[model samples]
Target chain A: MFLGVLFSGGKDSVFACRRAMETDSVVCLITVISENPDSYMFHTPNVRWAHLIAEAIGVPQLLWSTRGEEEAELSDLRDAVAAAKKSYGIEGVVTGAIESVYQAARVQRICRELDLWCYNPLWQIDQVEYLRLLVEEGFEVIVTGVFAYPLDESWVGAKIDDRLIRELESLQKRYGINPSGEGGELETFVLDGPILKKRIEILRASKTYENYRGRLTIEEARLVDK
Target chain B: MILIVDLCHKAESLSKYEFVDPIASIVRRTGSEFKVRHFSELTAKEIERSDGIVLCGTPLKDDLRARRIELFIWIRDFDRPLLAICAGMQVVAAVFGGEIVPQPKIGLERIEILKETDLLGPPGEIEGYHLHNFGVTLPSGFDLVAGRAGQIEAFKHSGRPIYGIIFHPEVRNKWIVERFLDLG
Candidate 1:
């Protein structure tokens, strides 16, 4: 059966897509862009990188833009997924929802309404183990946003490695971080992956720290053929 | 190090929800360690082996069954410091002599600390997220620590180390988590 993978260019979504491809042919990658500055639904302000990841994965990418506001954004997502499913004749959809029942439940509801099977392969996996596997699998990931108190601008562009994993373990021992960034403590963007035929070259970037939050903006980036 | 008891299978993922990073930041700031494991992973002996215990929030709406009863018994006998948020708070109330009944759907709201307690720090109002339908009616000997709009927002067992807050401190302001880490 053909499936659509929800691509966020994040470790979780990439891993989920990888696993889904192991069992099913994923036809399209879907991403939702939010215009709202304080949107809770969208992962980041810009998702242009997601387009490159979709290209690397050898799948058609669909960008669905929304206001990023709560209920309205959710509606837009539901519509987007439904449209993708219909247009691509997809039988199912895959998500990388590690936690957050609100997110999972909403997606499930949309899938149910669209009459498409919803697959969340990484739903209940241990967060620490999941993070470790991402590193072990040679997925080159970098921190793009730091919203938690302990994480600062220093964490931006930091690679996910053994040292970072150890730090996560230590943080878990001390602060109650999920170690997986499941609690919105941090956000990441994958620059390269196993399925990637090219690497992302960041042309220009800037880090802005305000209100104890650090956001790394990718001013310019392009996919370089490897 | 902080020991968070994973009550429900889905509750473990609550750590991945909002404010997870900030909580991690606090942990890193304090140079402490934290671990999230299922309740079944801990025995009575293990329960006694931590600096502090945080009962993570669960999606389970009600905890009035036999399994919950057994778990509550274990928590009551365990004399370690405890902090409960959202569903954790409801479980705490039910475990103690307090009662948990359906309350209004109050989303994110500023919690006014009615009294100064070490759990929340010097008395001041703080913004906290509330996503539970159950509210607690404190039993005797459990003093209320904080509240919002006349609701029993937070309460601590006077003679024991158990504490419960109706709102999610982990998802709220960083100070609440800082105070919780201080317990460790």
Candidate 2:
């Protein structure tokens, strides 16, 4: 079965696609480009690089825009899935929701309305395990933003692996934050994965911090050899 | 608050996404806290601190069985609200002189609820998903509250909040643990 992945150019979405590839043929990467940085349903960090990341993964991407309003973002996702079904004949949609019932339920409802299967391989999954599995499966992910205490500007552009997993575990014990950043504590981007044909090389980037939260803005990135 | 004791096999084939996540999700959905620890790492102090405890599933490795048996004794003595699920239940039964018989491979099997208990929801027929290579023949004190024929589905400690269920409650009857939320 061919499926369209709801991509955010973040770690969860890319990791979800990788897992989806094991059981289904991933037809396309549907990325929602939200203008509102604080959008409730959509991920906005590093979303501009969806095309490059899609190229690295060798999947055709469908980019859609929205105002990123509260409930209206669900419509944007529905439209993206509808387009994927029309263009690529996708039978299902994949999302990277682990612990967020808000996101998972909305996607499920949208899929039900669209008459398509909604697969959430990471639904209600343990974040510590999710992050560890993401790394153990040979996926290279970098932190793009940190939005919680204990995870400050230092986490920006850090790669996720065993060492980072340990740090995240420690942070989780202290701050009770989501190890996979499901609580909006942090955001990530995948550079390489099992299904990716090429790796992403970050050429230039900058960090901006406000009110203790910091984001890594990618100025330049390109696909490279594995 | 709930404490989910992890007995999941840590073999290379198994990731850390133990069956406890779904159970913890139920706990979290009910606006409670959940803390997870490996059976070996768990201390009696933590057990005393938690409102309830969950003994999650794991492969019946010889080493795991030994550790789980030790933990089961400690859990029984603590006398806290406990739900021993799947292999966790087998460990509890094995500690009580019950025989753990390796069974034929089976899938979903509906079991009749012989009596009412807070551990399992409702009183009538309930379909449970089974995926175990082993089942327990209970000792003298344990009572069979729910089962399908000779196969024991659930057993109560006769006095405590402790329960042992052969089938996986997290998958099929997720609402099975809803009663456990109010336990603590």
Residues B117-146, candidate 1, lDDT per residue (tens digit)?
778766788877665556878866788888
Encode model 2's per-residue lDDT on B91-140: one tens digit a residue. 78887778778763334667888878887756688776665667888766
lDDT of 2 by residue, A71-93 (tens): 78778878888998999999778
**Any idea how many clashes model 1 has?**
13
TM-score to native of every candidate shown: 0.58, 0.61
True contacts kept of each: 0.00, 0.05
Residue A136, candidate 2: C-alpha displacement in angstroms: 1.6
lDDT of 1 at A11: 81
Predictions in order: lDDT: 0.72, 0.78
DockQ of 2: 0.06
Per lDDT, the best of the predicted structures is 2
Q: Per candidate, chain B TM-score?
A: 0.81, 0.88
**Runs in model 1 lying further than 4 Å from the true structure:** A1-6, A10-30, A33-74, A78-137, A141-191, A194-226, B10-25, B33-35, B59-67, B104-107, B148-150, B181-184
